[model samples]
Target: MQSNRGTPLTPSQAASPHAAAVADSSVTRSASQQALILAGVCIAVLVLPLNFGGAAVSAPTIGTALRGSPVAINWILNAFMLSFGSSLMVAGALADLLGRKRVFAVGVALFAATSLGISAAPSLVWVDFLRALQGIAAALVLAGSSAALAQEFDGHGRARAFSMLGTTFGVGLALGPLLAGFLTQTFGWRSFFLADAAIGLTGFALGVPKLRESYDPHANGLDWPGAISFTAALTLFTFGLLQGPESGWSSPLIVALFVGAAVMAIAFVWIEGRVTRPMLDLSLFRYPRFVGVQVLPLATAFCYVTLLLVLPTRFIGIEGHTAIGAGLMMVSLSAPMLFVPLTAAHLTRWMSAGVISAIGLVIAAIGMLWFSGIGFDASATVLAIPLFVIGVGAGLPWGLMDGLSVSVVPKERAGMATGIFSTTRVAGEGMTLAVASAILAVLTRLRLADALPGSPDASAHAVTEAAQRVATGDLAHAAAFLPALGQPVLVHAYDGAFRVLLHMLVAITLASAIMVLGFLGRTPSPTSRDPASPTLS
Candidate 1:
């Protein structure tokens, strides 16, 4: 009776039911608030991946409608990715210093606004501008929302919450192509943007009010120098690659870009080493398992994400498949993303994650080789086998990598581990895609030159333009530029150029697999979890 005030009482110890009833009400209220917070963040997360997968499928349609150069069309995708990838670490740092909820709400609002703006864009330039802005907003939304979600749960609850978040991202990627294809095929490309805009607005309304504000007490101020240097470095590097095929690789402009890129990269490394709370925690790279964790995403970028754009272009641009038909075929490539992760999670019962990842990559390499032999005459069912195999192979490591990201490092370093992994995963995709695009364009240009009619009518200028057009998935317009060779010859040239790129991807992917296996061989599995530490499974 002297100290019952702060204690939860048994039924017999309670003087009246009123006190117990009040305590029960407080518990109920706390549970209700948690549900609201989870709902808001998950809804916002869905639209970001949706754009990645959706926009890839819509490329051919967007190209035809927007009437831009192959370079210009390529910019549409790279512009978004570059801004998003380069901005993520900075955005995360800012979220920690300011408030997670504040950044998250603003991000959602800006994302919604940009989506709406892209929907009504009159030209590719407008779309490109808005898409880059959308990417920055996307980084803010992702960084803040995930951190906020982590703050609300602990241990098993935290793992489960993040698992749900991962699955939501999976669902978006799984459904993006099909949904975008349907909308584009039925109405127009603009409809896809409009649909995403509606989804973004709904997320904003649901999440903004329920989200609680929080900040990292230990976070130092933002690293402005590191952010600027890193962004500039990547921008210069990507520009050099993209413009190399058009402007002679030895051109003064191209050389300057490359040199600038190298200088900025060195500056970024210097800045990170000196910063109190660095944008990149360079110390983590010293660990072999942590290094391997980084390799996994770069491998996937080459094998899986790069194909999302390439396959859609081949199906709709060159082979004349309808958007709906291409979308249906893409199900073979992307649908495994939805379920294979679950299957791979169970495989850990028999094998190490590294073994499983390496084996998966080997399988993808084989599938890519098989795809190199496929031609336009092959039936859809026959075509899908290689693509499906690639999908399953990629899915195995995809499931395990998220957990490995945090678990590979010590508990105190988990946040930094996650930031590095997320940045690598995203930035890897952008840089890889840009490089792949350059190779495809450059190779296609050479092949087209060889296939040219060797008459005065077929000039080198014409060959370059046609090849650029073809690289961007515009076989019809590309064919128009080189009428002497006929469309058949142009298509064949494109096919030959493409097979070489596929072989290159196969080699790089297998090499990365070996690196991951060697590096992750000795790292131990996490045995115990702290209830207060944030993590994902």
Candidate 2:
């Protein structure tokens, strides 16, 4: 029988053979629907993080193979983040307006096609183009599929479903580094894309047909003007950050981009207020739970997600660890995600989820500080403890975020809620990743400005070039540019920049902990999953 919490049952319940077919057909049907969602989403969860963690590990190799510059190297990663992050809000709202099954199928199909194209691309330009395109597909998959999963489960079941989601994400991340290392070392980085295509298509084939169509009856057509303005704002701001260091922060072009981004952001907010059906409902931000949920992903973006890119490159490119070795080292960072999220979920019975999240952030802050103390001199064994600690802290909020996202809002608005929270998480990651790269480059340049032996103008240009290469883990190229002192000087300069980055992360994590606790600590936790429930209480 269907539970009192209203677990969705399949229409074709009579087809199920479980529980003697006649008895509790609803139970069998509910099982079937949950199985479909879990299968599809689990497949997607596996492949998506592979692209993230695997691709980061593959970056230095890709740069060397493609003969890419520092700008080119960073863009390969940021292009995906920018396009994927900025598009999520619209994708979520789109799912609510259109059919969730339709959006999801299109996303997975597009993913397979793009992965194929990326694998065959001969240049960084083509690769970057495809990666950005892939982000759009990723946005669709995340929004459509996650919302579908949210629709099928409720109460304890809903919590469990999302916990599984977090755990699957962890599995992918944990495995991504090692898998990327092996593929890049043996078959080449391009093979990783080949793997993505195969796994994604298999998931598509298995899961799409099982998912039923869903749409919010109350949703009007998408607010196109708001969508466009929001995307433009995000794209412009990210581009400005990426271009600032190289173009001169005050360059007319960079300055214009920042100004345009600010104008567009304001326009988006204005348009949302006036629209009868806004793409992003501005009214949702009034609720503290809504704001608190958003902060969870944003914090993870800084403390955990950025490291997925930063550390892989640092280990393989500068520290001289093999791709496989770096992968093994990263397992410490990725493993907690596998188990800690469930532990966090179970803990909610005794403690407020908000308090749990706050404690986790504190732990992550401590890990970041411990991590920063180590230099290139440290071994993988020495690095493991800190990496594991960081992962443990991040996993707590990761476990609860998806479940809380749906519980805080009306059931009909799951898609929009998913989008807003995801957009903040990803857009923040992309923009922060861009900003962090630029800041590191600038800091590295300043450190080397006086050390180079050339005349003022020549030295200025050399330092700038050297810093770019150093920031991307291209030490050989950087050494070539600065012949006076070689690799040691480059390594020393990078360490200084990295230290500053760690300090920023620690400070931000601590503040985020405080912000989230204040916003959500008093809010009641959801005890029973109500299909139509809006607030946790």
Candidate 3:
């Protein structure tokens, strides 16, 4: 039953050792029952983060109570993302080595405990530390859940399972803000962390009985060096990108950090090639379809994050919508996510993954183009259409690409493949935001220069400061200039930003389309089993 390439199962067979252990027992439930249980666990794990954004308004109050600086407040949020992103590969590798169910249970316990700590922390430093712990817990849950899903189902069942996972993720992203708002408005910001604790505990209780051990006993030992090097490289690179805008891009510290990151990355590649128990096998890119599938998520995530950053400011700052109203308007951006998984599953019955991905990219490109036309006077409803379209575009690719990537590989390597795919998606999103913001900054300065001529010192300084403020979305400072010059300068800067974002979307979409068409030729028949399956591999 071992697959040749490294996927655990063919998407049609069970890869869990527990499945075999229970195969002869008359006490086993039907496949549908097991799937439902697994899906419920996935949803429970995902709901932990749903209230994050809503807590944004309450962060200041929390910060004051904890005696933390504004910088500490930022860390409280960023710590989660950084830890979550950096620990993914490590979590996945551990799961493949130690068994998924055991590691997953451990993660759930840690997550619940850390959430409680975060909720009760008396100082900013404690809160930030707990948040990083919570993020590590999240990485464990996410990595284990994904690999387990791939192990438990194959073929159309696999498609449905992947769709369910995507749906769970989408729900989390959409509800996070709404839940945060309600909890913060009523019980205070601490309720958000409390909620995460509750959810994590619930998942642990359910998963203990239903989740089964899934791991290849033949898997290699942990590659600690590779893991450390990879984590350090990604962390340094992300830190440099995030700080470059604020610290001055040409600063010695920033330049040195990037250089260090580059060196670490090169060393990581070299180490992986020689290590017997590599954390990530660079050889996976040899499969053209696998490579193509990876690119779709990278491109999609890049555009998705950019849109999320750009749109709300356009609504509230330019159109004068209240914060709550702007948030409501942005709901359209996530609405399509609700239906995309089911839609993608149905479409996969007839369409190849490549075709589906290409179509999605085209839809996303069109949406980006539509968004570019938005101006200072645009109505909320007018913006919703493109936002919804963008959501639809983003929704389909996540599940489709994820399913395809795992499906193409052999079962034994499923964990590594999943980890790599996830890492690329996060890296793409971070890089996209940084790159797009940099471009917008440059364009805004040029426009500012053109608008404020005849006074070189004033014009140069004003343009530089304005560009920085806009990149950071400092509306107060941006509004200060509106009184001095007519609002035309601000409007032009916004327009330039939007235009550049649109072109980026188009270029990325086109690249994604080409990759899909040229590399992902067709969906292979769902017959081959993944060699990574515990029993088979």
Could you say which candidate leads in TM-score? 1
Instruction: Identify the runs in model 1 with alpha carbons over 4 angstroms from their true place.
Output: 1-33, 455-458, 526-537
lDDT tens readout by residue for model 1, 1-537: 111122221111111111111111122326666767677677777788788878878878987998987877887888888888888888877676676778788888888899899889999889888988988998888877766665556556666776677777777877888888999999999999888888877877777786666655555576789889999998899888888887868999999999999999999999988977677778889877888999998998899988976788888888888888888888888888877877777777777777888888998889889999998889899989999999999888887776677678775465567677777887778899899999998889888887765645438778888888888889888888888888888788778888999999999999998998898755543322221111111
The C-alpha local distance difference test score for the whole of candidate 3 amounts to 0.62
Give the clashing residue pairs of candidate 1, or none. none
lDDT of 2 at 462: 73
List candidate 2 segments past 4 Å from native: 1-37, 150-163, 217-220, 406-415, 453-455, 526-537
Off by over 4 Å in 3: 1-40, 48-79, 113-131, 147-163, 181-191, 209-216, 309-323, 407-415, 437-469, 477-495, 521-537
Candidate 3 C-alpha RMSD relative to the actual structure = 5.7
Task: Encode model 3's per-residue lDDT on 130-157: one tens digit a residue.
Answer: 8878778877776666556555555666
lDDT of 2 by residue, 1-537 (tens): 121234421111101101011111243346776777677767864677778788888888888788887888898889888888777767766665575667778888888899999899899888889999998988887766765655556567765675566556677878888898888888988998999999998888777876666654444566689889988998899888877777788999999999999999999999989977666667778877888888888888888888878888789878888888888888899888767877887888888878888899999999999999998898788999999999999888777776676567665454346456656777888987987889888988888875666447856667788889889999999888888868988889898889898889999999999998997776555433321111000
- TM-score, ranked from best to worst: 1, 2, 3
Error of 2 at 73 (Å): 1.3
Name the better of 2 and 3 by TM-score.
2
